[model samples]
Each structure stands twice: as C-alpha cells, then as structure tokens.
Target: MAPMNIFDNTETAFQLKSDSELERAYFLFKMISMEPLVKIGSAVTKFALNVNLPVEGLIRSTVFDHFCGGVNERDCMGTVDRLHDVGVSSVLDFSVEGKEEDAQFDATANKVIELTLLSKNMEAMPFCVFKPTGFGRFKIYQKITENQALTENDKEEWKSIESRYDKVSKTAHASGIRLLIDAEESWMQDAADELCEKMMEKYNVDRPIVFNTLQCYRWDRLEYLKKLHQRAKAKGYKLGFKIVRGAYMEKENDRAIEKGYKSPICESKKATDDNFNEVLAYILNNLDDIELFIGTHNEYSSYLAMELMEQKGISKSDDRVWFGQLFGMSDHISFNLGAIGYNVAKYIPFGPVKDVMPYLIRRAEENTSVAGQTSRELTLLKKEKQRRKL
Candidate 1:
C-alpha cells in the first residue's frame, strides 16, 4: 500500500480506461486548451443546435461522455459501481438547465428527491446535489433577494418553492444522505443563500444533512463564511459549507458592467485562491462545528487542505473534510486521494446530451479561462499514457 499523502500518482486510477479512451482524452484536452477554438466551437455548436442539426452524436462522443455520469439517475449506476470498486464515491448532480415553468420545477424537485432516496442504501452513491433555480423562477429569486414585495399570486408561488426545498431536504435527512445546493450567479444568490440557510438550520440541527455552497471567488465569501459560522454558533446548528473558487465569473462581471455596479468577483485569481485557502483554514480550524467539502480542481489547494488536516491532527479519513474534483477532469487527484483512503469523490454531472449542452459549453469555457487547466489535464493524461506505453 502507498503512504497516506495525496500527491502520489496512482496508476490504478486509469486502469479501467483503454488506450483509445486515453488518446481521445488527450485530443479533447488539446482541443479545449485553444481558447479561440473553444469560443468559435461554442458559437458554432449553439448555431447548429438552433437549426436542429444532428449534433447529439458528436457531443455524446466527446465532452458529454468525458464529463457526465449518464443520461439519468438509473443510467448512472454502472458508473457508481466502477468508482466504488476503486474506493471513490460519487456526488451525483443533475445537470438539466433553463427550466422555469411550474411543472418543470416540480419535476426537477421530484428528480432530486428521488436521487436522495436512491442514495439511502447505496454506499457508492454518497450524496445528492441540485441547483435551487431548478425548483423556482430566477426572477422570483431576484425579487425576493432585493426585498421586493410580491403580489398574492407570486407569494403563493414562492411558498410552493419553499415546500419543494423542504421536501428535498427532509427526504435527505430521512434517508441519511447528505445534499449539496450548488452556487449560482450573484444577483439571485441571496435567495438561494437564504433558502439553503433555512434548510441547514432545520436539517442540520443534529447532523449535516444539507450543505450550502460558497463561491470564494466572489471576494465576499470569507466574511460570509464568518457570518454563517457565528450564526451556526448562536443558533446551535452545524454549518455545512462546500467552498469552490467559483463558476460564472464572466457572466457575473458582464452583468455588473451592464447594471453599472462593481463586479462581485475578485480582482485577481490570486485573491480568490488566497481567500479560498484562508476560508479553508478557518473551516479546518473550526472542524468541531463545520463539515466542509473542498470542491476544487486546483492541486495546490488540495495539498493545502491535506496540510491543514495534518496540522490540526485530523486523520486523512476524517469524514468532516472532503476533496472533490469534477467526474472527468481530475482523475489524478480523485484516484490518488481515494487510493490513500482519504475522503474524496468526483462531482458527477448527469443529464441528456441536448439538455446538457449549455453545461458542456460552460465546462469548455471554464477550462480555457482557468489559466492552464487544460494544459494540466493534458500533461497528466500524457504522463499516464507514456507510462502505459500507449
């Protein structure tokens, strides 16, 4: 057996994937590393979809297959089994987006509840995750966040959303499965934050069954974490915080420019990384009252988390702390950490190919924007490929 450090490269991580698959991954990352190509490809793909072109097969073979779990909950089981065989768990995330209708929202909520129930007995499937906007309108969320008064009909609609949040959370608590609420854009985050806080207060009264995600790239999340910690301290509830550097940086900055307000994003990547590590240190220091999930692809951040755990005398297997990378992007980190008996899992985003095209595009954009992400993934794949003599 290897030592307990997360830095070691485990050849076993890619044992199940074939040489052809490895080459395909290398090609994909090579394509994504070209920022101009990504921009043009995203535009062309969207245009093709708009004209109802036959693109599903093309997408399914490339980014979708590489990144997603499967098309649906049942479809993801085989993947769950494979990860479990390697001692890594799955945090299943449903990736359908652009939903705003009442019926659509209700169905999404049901799917989330169903996933939580499914996780109840499955050791491989450890957690369920969903976005709040999947259950309610974005406009309503914005209005609520801005403290705008709602008409009677809108109030009733908001009540319906609250009921849906309760159902998913209560089901997670009942099933003994933890849930993560994904972070979204800044304009409507207040509503999402408030709803997540409410659910955490209720479901986390005993244990951390519900987790609130924080985007540390926002420049405000360090203080936000502090405020939540104080509230958890005063209200006698555990704070379940999953911190990420963030998505939606371009969107957030664009909207801020359009609205003539200062951007909510950090001025630089270093600021975000520094604040993320600072908040991570605080979470580790206050492990008595917080269950943390460090959802990041940054290897240095992962190493920093492991270092913090060691300094605090927290075991590598500590359940309260977890390191997460997306399902396809960081097999090196995920498998190495899992191989060493550290608490870790892949973030498995799943949905139909067409319904998930937006997510795929965002993933591509994130890779190109996150400075060397694609290069890093490509380097790791090439290293593994060379070792296997592929």
Candidate 2:
C-alpha cells in the first residue's frame, strides 16, 4: 500500500486525543475553514486582549491549548513526555512574535539558550527553534538585505544580533541539539540565511547542528540551495535545511507589486509544490552532505518523500531526514509516520498566552488562506469523531 494510505488510519492518527479534545479540534478546524469568521474572530480576539479583557483563560482553554504546548517550558513538560511515548519528538518553538526592542531580543535569545540546555537531557525534545527576527530588529535585516549603508547605531545593532546568533548556536552545539532557525519575509531572509550558514560552518563540522529554513514557494530557493550546497561542500561543512512551502505568499506578492519588483513567490500552488518536491529530492539525493528536515502538511508531498526514500534504499529511521508538522495540525502524518519508525516531530509552540496570540492568529489566517488545508483537517477530524462513535 502507498504511504498516503497509512494516513487514513485515524485510530493511530488521533490516539492521544480524548473524545472531548477531538471534538474541540473538529470545532477549531470548522471555524478555521470559514475565512470571514477567521477574520472577524481574529479582530475580536485582538481587541479583547488589547482592552485587558479577562479572556486569557478562554483563549488558553481553546485555540491556545490545542495549538501550543504550553505557556512556558515547565508547562510543556507533560506534552513533551506524552509525545515521546509515541515516538514523535518535539521542537519547542518560542512562538512569541512582533517584538523589536533590544531587551526583548536578548530575552528571546536567552530563552532559546535555556531551551537548548533543557533539551539536552530530554529524549523527546531534540530541536530548539527561534525566528531570526526574534533575535533582532526586522528593519535592520531589511536594510542589510537592500544593501543600504547602515549608520553606526545600525551597525552596533547588527553586531548585537550576530552575537545573539552565535551565543544560541554555540549553546546548541555544546548541548548536541539541532537548532532550526526559521525563515521570515523574503526581504529579510538573505541576512538570516547568511547568519545561519555562518553558524553551520562553525558547528556542523562533526554533524549538522544548525539548520536553516528554505521557503520553497519562492522560485529562487532551489537554485539558492544548490549554490549554498556548493559553498558548504567547498568550505568543508555539512548543510542542514528545513524546507517548507512558505507562509508569506500573499504578503510577498503584495509587497512586490507595491514596490514594483517581481514577486518572490511562485506563480501558483502547483509550481510551489513542484519546487518543494525538487528541493526534497535534491537533499535526499545528497544525504551524505545535506541533512534535511521536511516541514510540510501536504499528504502527497509526505508520501512522495517516503517513496523516494524507499526507492533509494534509505532507512525509514535515518537521522539525516525528519518529517515535521505543527503541534495541533496534521496529526495523521506525524503519528502515522512515527508508528512506522520514521523520524517525525511536531513543532510545539509555547509562550505566554498574550505573546503567542500573533502566532496563533497567523496560523489560523494561514490555514484559511491555504486552499483545501482547513477542509482537509476538518474531514480527517470528522472521520476520527465518527470512528470513535462520538
């Protein structure tokens, strides 16, 4: 049978969810499927939180609980242990977003360092993740990407950013944890890529300790990967990447049209899928030199990966390859693959309720935007609900 057929086993897919938890997930995806509801709900949630309405509990009990591991590391321990029991690993992602102050950057960096140290002793938690903008100002990265000359203050800020990157990456290397540095907007990604490559060179000597993300929705990423691979081979270091179909397509396209430049995103979803598959194949083919973390929610893509690995006689449990999805979504893929001895992980986001709202809201909005994703989630969840006679 095809690998995708395994995903139909909802019994294994949602083995961890209680009947009530399953119902909540079904309802959440139902809400997410309605685009207008998502928009209105997002605005209302933001307003309620802004006016200091006592809605954190409600938020925490609903979307926050379903999508995130917990509000802090201690709060997430139960989740870590539970996932580990089923052979799925966790990457504790600090999902707080939109902060720009230097102090906040330092705090985020320190949090990553703390998580790296914590993950060193936890079998379930194998990866630590943080956004590039989480460590510094987005404008500074934008300035660097645009090749604009920075003032002394900007240079100082850039230095501080580099220091944060080095500090976190060095800690991860020492702890023997793989650090996944997330990609952001196209304009700022160039600087992040350069910084991640620097970390890879410094720490990936013995193995891949630092992984950069490639948003394959962008037409240029495959070529960029090829070029980066050549550079890493020449420099005597391994390259690690977490490849995704990207998250900022609408924003990227809108910004390109507004600024009179070509859009970085592919022309259509088909093109993005093709590019993602191509990049996946490229990394799999060169597994000796490149370690891959396949971060996707599409079933076909996941099945294609499994097929390719089998065709090449690669072990299903290869350390160089991993499959990842978000914490709440795509349990079918995560759990089913884990059941079969694949290296699978869920990106478990955790932060304060208020701080993680932006990330949660984006996840909802992105779900609504991605054609068929929310509906597919709803369908699988409903199937599970029916199967359990709930």
Candidate 3:
C-alpha cells in the first residue's frame, strides 16, 4: 500500500510561501469557507465592477494574487519559474470567459497559439489549455450537440471555430507541447468531445499532443471513454485524457429537472467518486494506448493513482502519467508529489482582473461547496503557520 499521510508534510508543501503569504492563504480560505460571505461577495464584486468602482486593486491584492498567475503570459513567468524551482510544471490557463463575438474568439485562439510558441523553449511550462467556448459561441456547440438544424450562418461560425482549433493544435504539435481541451456543460460537451477527437486523430499520431477532458461526474463517461478508445485504436492513433470530477453539478441537475429529463450527473457524490476512480483505473490499465493527466485535488485519488502505478510497476517519473492541480489550491498534493519525483503541474489561471472575475468567483464558490476542500486547506495552512512560528 502507498504510504498514508504522505501529503501532510507542511514544510514541503509551503516551502515557497513566506510568512505573510501563508497568513494570507489561511485568511483567504477562511473567507471562502463561509458560504454566505462568498455569495454576497460575488454579487457585490460583480456590481462594483459593472459600476466602475475602484475595487480592482483590492481584488488583485487578495484573491487574485493568490489564485492567479497574472494578467498575461509574460506576467505569469515569475510564478511559473517559482513553481518550476520546486519541480512542479505549469499549464498557463487564460481564464477569461463570456465572449460571443468572432473577434474575441479569434483573439483567444491567437493568444493560445502565442502561448504555445512562447512555451516551446520553456521547461517550466510544458502544457497549454483552453476551454471549448473560448474558441466559439456556446449556442453553436449546443445546437450541434442536440443535432438541431443549423442556419447557414451557424455553419460558417462553426467552420471558423474549427479553424481556430486547428491553428492552435498545429502550433502545439509543432512546438512539442501538450494541449488540454477543457470540458464544459453536458449540453455542449458532445460537440467539444467530437472536435477534440478529430484533433487527436490529426496531431496525436506519435504521442498525445492533444488531450480531451473526462468529467467523471456523469455516469456515462466510462462507457464513452471505452467507445472512444476503441475508435482511436482502429484509427491508429494514441489517446490522451485529463480526468476531472467535474465542475457543474448543480447546474446540470437543475437543468435536468427543468427540462424533465434524467440528470446525466451521478446521483450522489460517492457515486461520482466511484466513477472517477473507475475511469482512472481504466486509463491506467491501458497506458499502452492512452496517456493520462489526473487533474484532481482529492488526496485519496492521488494516493490511489500512486498505489495503482506501484502495483503496475510504472516508474514514478513516467512521462505518460501526470498529476495536476489548480494554482493556489492543494499545495500539499502538488508540492509533495513533486518533491517525491512525480510528474505534476499546476493550472495557472491568468487574465485581465475585471475579465477573470467570473473564474475567480467560481473558484471561491467551488471551494466553499466542495466538501472538506476548504477545511483541508485551512488545516494545512494552520499547520504550516505553527511550523513557521509566525
């Protein structure tokens, strides 16, 4: 069995954080643990930003600095280098959201391509990620997912979206960098999944340069993965997947109820955990054909992956396996894993302060909602504080 409490080493976990920074993290998690404060603060922040209130500085100093790398690729290098010093790599995530225009989509695509080029020689950053909606409108994906008839303009729009994806994927392949395509709402995910597979067929010829996400909250994901694996095998291409526990459970359930359809989400959190572990085991078992990026902060999942890898005699530094966590969260897992020679990366989110508020707010709300996430963070922070005697 893998060692228990391997993640409890506060010294290694917070080795990079200064006394002040540790206190700030503790305070931030404390604030996030209060569900009511997060709701009220999210609303007020939105209002303040909309009315041109001078809250950007305040936001940047506290949550933004802690959670985000910076506003742009160049701005993020310091954080990137810092993490790399401790053996953890980074995935630069441009976290801006809610765009409905062609120009915005093109710009996002261009930024991703530019970032991929920038990372070509940088060992600190080996990966790039972008959301499906970042390259096109949500409605387009939903329409295609539902198999509804598209207007002529929709076809043109979708073609543009595909062009954007192709440009980014080609650049990533050429630069020898891996690209992660994030999953979104279930209504729109089918279209994204199909497009991602197409990219994998084109770019993942030698290895997995293009990876799609599997949100295991949905019970059907394991079956979907099995079918996709069969297709990839027949088509003669490698496959890569980033497995996540999903992010939109409440929205998924509420939408299902309103539409009078069965929810695609698993019925309980335990079921979701089971589904995630099952899929993880499946991909690990098929590492010959599929490379995996385990994107979770759950300690048990991390430990399980370690145990499974041990049982299979996989090297701790196997290039085909990676562990990932978001920046500013789960330092215990990220840093300790890196310290022990596991391949790990942090998803470093960055964007303009005002534009990335939605992402930041969602992070706060998610921390509040996920059971034990905030408390665990607080516990580690406290332990680190005591160790530092600060």
Q: Which model scores highest in lDDT?
A: 3
What would the C-alpha RMSD of candidate 2 be, to one decimal place?
1.0
Q: Which model is ahead, 2 or 3, in terms of lDDT?
A: 3
Q: Pick by TM-score: which candidate is best?
A: 3
Candidate 1 off by > 4 Å:
1-10
What lDDT does model 3 reach? Answer: 0.96
For candidate 3, lDDT tens digit of each residue in 154-241? 9999999999999999999999999999999999999999999999999998999999999999999999999999999999999999
Model 1 weakest 10-residue run by lDDT: 1-10
> What Cα-based lDDT does every candidate model obtain?
0.87, 0.94, 0.96
lDDT of 2 by residue, 331-356 (tens): 99999999999999999999999999
RMSD (Cα, Å) for all candidates, in order, is: 1.9, 1.0, 0.8
**How would you order the candidates by TM-score, starting with the best?**
3, 2, 1
Residue pairs clashing, model 3: none
Clash totals, every prediction: 0, 0, 0
Q: What lDDT tens digits, residue by residue, belong to model 1 across residues 100-196?
A: 7999999999999988888898988778898988899999998988899899988999999999999999999999988999998998999999989
Model 1: colliding residue pairs: none
